[model samples]
Structure formats: structure tokens, C-alpha cells
Target: MKKIKYVALLAIVFTILFVTKANAQTWNIGFPDTTKVKAILTGNKLVIEGKGAMKNYPRHKIWKDSVTSVYIKKGVTNIGHHAFYDCRELKTITIPDGVTSIGESAFKNCENLAAVIIPNSVTVIKRNAFERCTSLKAVSIPDNILEIEEYAFYECFSLENVLLGNGLNQIGDCAFRACHNLSSITIPKSTSTIGEIAFRECYNMQNFEVEKGNIKYSSVDGVLFNKKQDTLVAYPNGKEGKYKIPESAVVIGNSAFASSKINAVRIPKTIKTIEGDAFRYCHNLSKLKVPNSVEEIGILPFANCDSLERIKLGSGITEIGMYILSQNENLLKIKIAHKNLKFSSKKGILYNKSRDTLVMYPRGKKGSFMIPENVICIKKGAFEDCQGLTEIVIPENVTTIEAIAFQYDRNLKTVTNRSTTPQKISSEVFSYVNLKNISLFVPSDVVDKYRNTDVWKEFGQIKAIE
Candidate 1:
């Protein structure tokens, strides 16, 4: 009988300890004046009763992992920055109607958060507010919101339905980038600014619909454009096959065709400018012909085009950006119109009009190559990723080799430099090349010069030309 009584006493003491620990988990969420607001964690629920905005919490808040649901009372006015960041287990949140803003990264990386009620009182959704919320399937932005900041919904893989409020005025850069399931979006009339790459990499997106009476933008056949339709703002990534640029379009906006499914594009003579990354990552694009009306080409316009075999540049192109044709694994040739006074092409290699500066070496070109006798300098990344190059001979006239000029030429085995005096170059000029096994041949008279140079000295074998 005494043993039974002792066991009962032990059970009572354990129960009391458990209750104390549970009560200790409750947190005061407001400022020093705790009387105004309080937050309690009971079981899987987070109950927040407040009269003002909650304080921002660091990424590793104690309750982030345990809370599966949140209920904010109507008196709360705002959701502070990073308030629930990385709350991977949070599945639902009831936002009160009086809240005016959702702070930056307020719910970022909450991968399991599937449902959230954004009340009509919110005026702004700060940057990265719901980024990486993979389980969120739909969102309806209320009519009172004014802006959605940069990267607000980036990489939200499951988001399929988005209803933008008529009062929204701006969509910041990359706000909805990489939202793969987002199939279509309608821009309300009140939206005046849609930032760059906002819808890039949305592989299933087929159209961008703009409401009528929009003063700043318009849409034609599901293509987004400026009010006058002279600038092609964006091309639906899901649109396939050949597309002809309208004669009225004078410019191709930045990233307009990035990661699109289009295989071919016809450029009309009216196009005068091709902005940066205009045709980047169009894996199916095989060939292109730039018309004579185009005068400028922005940075990396044709980079990473896996199937791009040839490109013909028109005579009017006076400005060309760096690495414009880099990383194109299948690009075999670059043709420049004879009338072009600034650039030229010879044997498929790009060069300055005077043939003095080697601009870019076709990454697809195979076998050995001899630099032209007139070439004096090789531009940065001129021969980057030329995987098939087994040998290269630099002429006597070459004086400079820029950074990364021959990087990643893993197959390169021999390099013969004809200049008696070694050209000064950075160590990055031949990055990733097998310097320990490749042979370097230099003029018999100055083999010692290459043997002492910084980058050249690293080559495995230094031999004098016979």
C-alpha cells in the first residue's frame, strides 16, 4: 500500500513539471509595454493579441519551428520584417484587417505555409515577403495594396493563381521570377511600372494580359508592350516556334526572350536597339540575322544559346557589348556585314575592323587555330570554354592577353607563342586549363623570357621553337 502511494505521488510531480514547461513557452511579442500586446504559444497554435505592430524577429526565433498556425487579432497594424522567416512548419496564418503592410521577408522560406489571408488594409508587400513559400497555391492581392516589391514571390514553385488588385501601381524587379507554375498574369490598368525580369523563367507562362485604358503599357496577341507598342517588353516563355518582330518595334527590351521556347525570330529593319539579355538562354534558337537598322546591341544578348549555330550582324551595328556571344556551345560562326566599319569576322572568328583586336573566338570551333598576324590584343573571354581546341599559336604581333581569354579550354595541349618578348597577362587568363600537362613553345631566342613570366612560368614544359 505504501509503494502504490509513492508511485501516485511521482506521477503528480511529473504532471506539474510538464504544465510549467508548457506555460513557459508563451512569449511577450510587443515592446517593453507588454500590456498593449501579447503572444502565446499553446500546442501548435500561435495566438497574437496586439494593438500595434509586432517586433521583427531574427531568422531563428524560438517559436518558428513549433508554430503550425497563427491567429493575429484585429488590432495589429503591421507584420514586422522577418517576423516569421524560415518558419518551415507554419501552414496557415490569419492576418487581421487593420494591418497596413507586410514587412520584408515577413514570411520568407515558409515552405509549408499553404494558406494566408491578406486583408484589404495592406498597402504594400515588401521585398521577399513570401519568397520560397513552395506550398502556397494561390493568392489574392486586395484592392488597397499599392506595390509589390522586388523578389516578393520569387521561386514560389506551387503558386498558380494570383489576382492583382486594381489599385496596384508598381511591380518591382524579379517580383515573380521563377514561379514555374504561374501560367498567365493580367496587369491591371492602375499598374504603371512592371520591373525587369519580373516574369522571367516562368516556363509555363503563355500570356500577359493588360487591362484596357492602361496608360503606360499594352498587350497584343498576349505579348506585353509599352503604350505605343514600339518596344517589345516581354515575350511569353511558353510561346513556341518562329516569331517576327513587328515593324513598329524599334527596341527589344531587356530579357524579352530569355529562357523562352522560341526557335527563331525575325528582326524587321525598324529595330534599332537590342537590350541586354534580349535573346539569352533561348535553347532552341538555331540562327539569327540582325537587320541593318539596329545600331546597338547590349550585354550578353545571345549568351547561353545552346543551339544557336550562326548569327549575322548587320552593317549598322556600331556598339557591341562584351561577352555578347560567350557560352554558346554550338555557335559555329558569326557573320558581320562588309559595310560594318567597327567589327569584322574572319574564318568564323570575331575581330575588330582593323583585325588588330581579337574580340571573340567561336566556342564551337575545333582543331588548331593560328591568330592573325595583325592581331595585337585578345579581349577578355575571347576564347572562353573552347572545349575542342587542341592547339593555339599566338602571332608575333600580339602584345596583350586579357583576363580569362582562354579559360576552361580543358582539351588544349599545346601553345606556341612567336613573340620574342612575352606579353604580360593575369593568372586568370588560362583558368581551368591543365597547365601542368600542356606544353608551351616560345621563340628560341627568348625561351628564358616565358620561363620567368608570372602566368607563362606555370606551364609544364617550356620548349624553344625549332
Candidate 2:
């Protein structure tokens, strides 16, 4: 059976490679007149020698699977897109100084394409240039290049190190998605925009050093200092169990520790901010202590940490990011030192623990809910997907009904709001429930105010108190 399985798998792989080759119709490398090169596959390397003809390498037509490592003749200048894409056996490529442009997806999805040396002469790198080369351990950006287009080197899961070229300015979105093995990166001074999710879902990347801070950007240790730079990040820089961040460190970039294996962390007092997801999804993480200087905790800062139950947020923290502590099944108690907390639930708000208004519930709780009136706003999605919640009530002083604030509750039904003549209503206040449209009681005098507004009309028939 094993032999048969292996044979079948090999057949499928060959079939796919053949299709990729079949679809690869006469792709040109340098353009103009160039002899067609034949694919010479020997052992693991695919040798294309320009047939020792044309006085140069073929500018057009390459067999994508015919070669594991491409050797360009001395005169080649441009390497076409997807020319060597998905060459699993490809390990290394040496692009001589002669090549100038490396087209998009040129070496993309080449899982085994490990080492590459881009010479100084190259200038433009098109989109999806080096995406998903899982085994691509490391590569250095050429200082001469001006831009690295979108989706460059994305999903290089095994990628661990990158040497940024001096002239680099922009890093496109999802550029380093799920680079599980990537440990650290340095952002040079010339870099400007670290695009959205530029490092999204990088599981193993722990620390970064930004030499020069961006005009409006910042960095922590080395992680992209998220908007609020107060939070600092430190992972197992080496395979150690204990670690501490220096006081000089400011912000802990988002997702900096999303998937780190650290058991504990101590955030110093110098940190004034903690970006969202700074320590998110730290599965093995068990304890955290935020110093008193931290005034804000960004949204979902500690979400999805299944093993985490204990965290210390000092007195200086004023605002708590929305769902910051959500889904922490082990979290049963949250001790807040700030008495005058101003927790705002406005517009699906991120809770401001610094305000000292709303009381964070213990991880495990039973039944009815009542949000104090002093709490000025109720954040959107604050209690989303809370499997334990059943019945709840809101105080009258509350004003906004944050979008999707109370959606996706399977058993939660019937919420009574006490806001006598509070503010306007928003959409999706009560949805995804099997029960009847739960009533929201508002003073009859102000029902007109909410009813007239376009935001509250379609959600589910609202009723006013007489």
C-alpha cells in the first residue's frame, strides 16, 4: 500500500508539473530575437546553457519545471515572471551583475529556493516577486533598488533572516505572511510605509530593530513599532525561558509575539502603550505584568491565549482595547488598579481600562449582566462570541449601539436597556439569535429621536416606552 501511495503521489506531482509546463507557452526572458533553449534536467539541477549559441542566453522561452537552478548566460539582463516559479527542487540561484530586472513571481512558490544574492545593478522588482518560497531561508535586498512591489516574499514560512538594502523605501502588504521561522528583521532608515499586514501572521518572528524611526512611524526593539510605540516586545531572542525588555524600549509592535513560545513576560514601567495583538496568540504564555506607565492597551492585545489566566495591568493603564481579554478561557480574574477607569463602549469601542469604569469579568461567569451607568460608552463586539453569556441588561446613560455589538450569540437572548432618553441607535444591535426580536426599552419621549434616524430602522423593529 505504501509503495502504491508513493507511486500515486509521484504521479500527481508529475501531472501538476507537466500542466505547469504545458501552460508555459514560449516565455521570453530578454525579448527580441533569441534562440529557444531546451530544458536539460540532470539529477536535481535543470541546466539551460543558452545552447552555447546566439552569443547570449535565450531571451525567450523557459521550461518552468525543466530546471531546478537557472544559470543565465553572461549577457542576460531581465528574468521573466513565473519563469522559475514553483520549482520545488530549486535551492540556489546566482544572478550575475548583468541582470537588472527580476520580474514578479520570478522565483515565487519555489519552496526549496533557499539562498539568493541580488546584485547591486538591479532596480525594479514587480508584484508578487518572491511570494511563498517556504524554504527560502534568507535573502538580502539590494541597496540600489527603489521599490519592492506588493506581495513580495509572502508566506515564506521557513524564512528566518532578511537583510534590507540601504535604498529600500516601501514593503508591500502581506509581504511576510506566516513566515513561521523568521526570527528578526531590521528596518533601515530609508524605509517609509510598512504596508498593512506587511508582517501579518508571522508566527516565529520575535524581535526587530528599526535603526531610524519613520516620520510618523516607530519601532520596538526591532518589531515595527505599531502606531502606539509605548509597548515594547521581546521574544526568546535565544532559546531561553526568562527575558526582560529594557526601559529604553517604547512600543511593542502588533503581532510581535503572536505565536511566541515564551512562558512569561515583564513589561517595564517606561512603556506607555501596548499595540493590539502585541502578545496575541501566545499559546504557551502563562503570565504578563504591564507596568504603571502604560496608559493604553490596544484591542485584542492578549486574545486567544488559551493557557493564559494571570495578567497584571498596572494603575497607569486607562484604556483597554476591545476584546483585549476575550477568549481567554483560563482568565477568571482581572485586577484593575485604576479606580476612576473611563471604559468607553462607543462605536464598537476599544475598552479604555485607564478610565476605570467597566469591571472586567472573571474568565468564567454565569447568567445575567448589568453594565453600570457611569460607563459612558459600550464598545462594539466587546462581548462577541462569549459562549457563556445568556441574558444581559444595559444602563440608560449609555448612548451608542456599536455595530455588531451583540451578534453571533447562540444562546444569548433578551437584553433590557435602561437608557431613559439616551442617544441614537446603530445597526445589528441584536442579530443571529433564535429567539424573538429582543426588546430594547427606551423612554417614549425619545423613541422618536432614535426611530427617525436611518441607522436604527432595519435591524429589528424597535419599540419605545410609553
Candidate 3:
């Protein structure tokens, strides 16, 4: 009877300890004393009464999943970074009027969070502050807010209406990306700078308006443009059909045509530059021409245009960015005008004028391809997703292979390296490739050296070639 009593006493002690640990995990830090803050969980609602700023929500995952509603009392001065991240069931939050800032990712991935009220005292909305809040239908920024950082409301699919305050000055890149239901935006006159892709992928947006007297930006036919209208910024993703760019546009901003469904685009002669990702994922676009006045083309300008079959470059083009025309599976030819001074092509493959760097290889080109003897560098993403080539031979002069150089070539079975020394390659060059199923053939004298290299050593078979 005495022994049984002792066992029960020990069980009681363990139960008490477990409850203490769980409670400790839910408590927020930064309080001067435990008595200065009071947090009570009643059913699904969490009530936090604190005298000063609260530290970022506890890192413990348990607090995130259990809290359905949070009532932050007026004494709290700040909401720390990632305070309520990934709280799938959190539907409503009351941010008090004294709060001055909302940190990065403060409420990221709160999929069911439907509404929030930003108090007038808040000055900054940091990067990814409300990212992926899929059910949040609307929000209004108070007049005291000074900045809205990158990806602040990214992928908020249900967000339809936004009311911006007059005090805001700067908006960061991708601030409102992929908010499919947002119908329009009006930038306040006090705003001076808006970053690239700030409103990209807002599929329902019919227009973007700048408040009258704004000095840095303007709108032309609902398209965002620089105040002078020399740079063409974002084109609403919802607008479809053939659209000719204005003849006065000198530069195409980053992501200018990203995720657009336009059937055709006519870049005018006045354009001097096409920035990175300018035409990415425009699957319906089939043809493009760079006029003679153009001087540069940025990275991946025409990537993933599935129906794009032909491209022509003008004579004045001097700079071509990496992966400029990658993933256009139907692209059969890329022709450069004869008077071009910076680049050339042989057999439809693009290269620098001196032929020292292989720029990109068309994915639609068939059969085996041999790298020219004079090429020394394979540019980044040069051969990405090129499944048509069953084999490749790298010439002896080639010394470096950049990142993702040969990625996703599932059908590639053999590679012949003519270099006597093992050429170094980036770790991502062969990413997603089944190295054990592919064979690597190296010069007979350097077979062992190639076998010792990091990426080459993983080949299924390393054979000596005379």
C-alpha cells in the first residue's frame, strides 16, 4: 500500500512539469517582468495585455497553430518579425493604436486570416509583412505609414480592395504580386518611388492610377509609366490581344510583360533596352523583333514563351544578357542582323562576336551538338531544359561551365569532354540530373583526374576516350 502511494506521487510531479513547459512556450518575451504582461488563452482566442513592445511571437510552432484570434492590447508598441507566421486558423487580429511598426513576415502564410486593422501610429510595413494571406479580402493603410516593403502583400489571392494613406513615400519590389483579385490601385501624390514588379500578376487590375501632381510616375492608357513616359513600366496582366508599345518608350522595365497573355508585341525602334524578365511566361506570344535602335537585352527576356518560334536581333544590339531566349521550346531560329557588332550565330546557336563564350543553345534544336573549339565559357543556363540533344561534346578550349548549364536534360545519355584537365563546374550545373544514368568520357590520360572532380565523379560510367 505504501509503494503504490509513492508511484502516484511521482506521476503527479511529471504532469505538473509538462504543463509548465507548454505554458512557457506560449509566452512572449521582452517584458521587463512577468507581472508586466498578461496572456490568457480562453478557448481559441488569445488575449495579450502588455505594457511595452512585444518580442517577435515565440518561435515555438505550437503557439501559431492554436491561436485563432489575437487581441493585442493598446500598450504594446510594436509587432515583431514573423510574430504570427503560418497560423492557418487565425481569422482576425486586433492591432492596437500604439503599435509603431510591423516587422518582416509578421503575418506571413496566415492562410485564413481574413481581416486586420492597421492603426494610425504604425510607420513601417516591412518586407513580406502579410505574404500569402490567402483569405484577406481587403485592407486600408493609415495616414502615418511611411513605407511598404517588398512582398508585403504577395500572393494574397482574395485581396480585392486597398486604400493607401497619404503619408506613404516608398513602395518596394513585388509589394503586391499575385494578388489576383485586386482591381485597381491609386498611388498617393506623396509617393516618390515604386520598385519593379510592385504590382505584377494582379490579373484583374484594369488600371493603375497615380494621384494628381505626383512627380515621379504617371499612367498612360492604364499602364504605369515614368513621369516623362520614356520608360514603360507594368502592363496590366488582365489586358489581352495584340498591343504595340508606344513609339516614344525608350526602356522596358523589369517584368513589364511578365505573365501577360498578349498574342503579339511590337517593340518600337525608340526602345534602347529590355530589362530582365521583361517578357517572361508570355506563353501566347509567338514572335518578337528587336529594332536597330536597341542597344541591350536583359536576362531571360523571352523565357518560357512556348509558342515563340522565331526571334530577330537588330544591328545596333551590343549587349545580350544570360538566358535571353531560354525555354522557348518551339523557337527554331534566332537570326542576327549582319551589321551587329557584339554578337553572332552559327547554325542558329547564339554566341559572342569573338565566339569565346557560348551564350545560349536553342532547346528545339535536335540531335547531338558540338561546342565550337574556340568557346571557353558556357554561360549560366546556356543549355537548361534542352531535351532534344541526346549527346554533347565539349571542346578542349572550354574551361568553365556556369550554373544550371545542363540542368533538366533527362534524355541526355553521354558527354564527351575533350579537355585533358577536369574543368570545374557549378554544383547546380547538373542539378536534377540522374548522374548515375549518364556516362562521362574523358581523355585517356586524364580519366583519373576527371573521376576525382566533384560533379564529374558522380557519372554512372567514366570511360577513357583515345
The worst-scoring run of ten residues by lDDT in candidate 1 lies at: 24-33
Using lDDT as the measure, name the better of candidate 1 and candidate 3.
Answer: 1
- Tens-digit lDDT string for candidate 3 (1-466): 8899999998989888777555643454444554566666655787778787766564445567788998989888888778788878898899989999998888999999998999999999999999999999999999899999999999999999999999999999999999999989999988998988988888888788889999988998888888999999888887888888898799999999898778898889899998999999888888888889888788888898898888888988887765788788888778888788888887778888888998878888777988989999998878888888789999999988999988888889999999998888867998888989999999999999988999999999999985
Q: Compute each candidate's TM-score over C-alphas.
A: 0.94, 0.62, 0.81
- How many pairs of residues collide in model 3? 0
lDDT of 2: 0.63
Kindly report which residue pairs in candidate 3 clash with one another: none
* Highest lDDT against the true fold, candidate: 1
Question: Which stretches of model 1 miss by more than 4 angstroms?
Answer: 1-21, 31-35
Backbone clashes in model 1: 0
lDDT of 2 by residue, 1-466 (tens): 9999999999999998887666544322234445543334444455443422222232133355556666665556666666676676677787767667788787777777777888887887767778888877887889987777778888887788888887888877667666767777787777876665566566556666676645535554454443445434334222335556666667666665666666677777777777787777777777777777778777888988878867766777665554878777676456544442553232222246443234345344456676766666655665665556676777776766665566566666555556665456454644565435445555667666555656443325566644
Clashing pairs in 1: none
Tell me the TM-score of model 3: 0.81
- The local distance difference test score of each candidate is 0.91, 0.63, 0.86
Give per-candidate clash totals.
0, 40, 0
